[model samples]
Target: MARTDTAFRVIAVPPARAFAALVDPAALTAWLPPEGMSGRFDHFDARPGGAYRMVLTYADASAAPGKATPGSDVVEARFVDIVPGVRVEQAVDFVSEDPAFAGTMLMVWEVTGVEGGTRVDIRAHDVPAGISAEDHAEGLASSLANLAAYLER
Candidate 1:
């Protein structure tokens, strides 16, 4: 079956602030990578139909193999939808030769105001078979934690 993973966290910030963190390329550069990885974007345009490409490099080369090159995974993505202070979505495709990883995926981020903070939910749709679900989930969780840390700072 095709796999889609979802993760959520509440941050101590308003929805507008949370939305900014999600959509701003600079903020993304600060917190998008999961633990043990770092990312750099080739270009980022946040408007609808805009596009971006990024390369994520593992801190340890051994950690990247079949899923990526010796040390990095490259992704080309487009901004699918963006609703200020509410939601953002992107269509993502990995730049890989392996058929198992040759597919376009969708990622959505929803931000809503809560009593004391903002509720942030992220959904990754149609994950490639080459990526382990457990590791992906951990990465998502780690990203959320990183975002929280960045926001709090």
Candidate 2:
């Protein structure tokens, strides 16, 4: 069965700044990876219909084997929509041979300006069965925290 996971964080930056971090390759490489993982993009183009390939490597793969390889998760994602200061949506797929991880996931990132800063909400739809809910939640939260730090600094 397909499932959805959502996470939100109040970042201490304006919506534009938060949205910029979402699309900039350098900013993404700096903050998109969750705890214990590091990410790099093979190619990046941030626009509607543009696509990018990202590889995420685990610092300690023994704890959690990757979906694409023993130590890494590779993702190919296309931009579905990009609304400045509001939202960025993407169609993402895991580059894995395993059947459990075969599917295109919709990742929507919405940023709304709040009193103190921005409220960033992430909604992931049709998450692959191979990814556990608890782990995904933690990963999302970790990435959000990283984003906050990246922007606030």
Off by over 4 Å in 2: none
Find the candidate with the highest TM-score and give its number: 2
Work out the TM-score per prediction: 0.96, 0.98
Question: Model 1: which residue pairs collide?
Answer: none
Q: What RMSD does model 2 have?
A: 0.7
Candidate 2 residue-wise lDDT, 1-153, digit = tens: 779999999998888899999999999999999999999999999999999999999999999999999999999999999998799999999999999899999999999999999999999999999888999999999999999999999
The number of clashing residue pairs in model 2 is 0
TM-score of 2: 0.98
Q: Which ranges of candidate 1 are over 4 A from the true structure?
A: 66-68
TM-score for candidate 1, residues paired by index = 0.96
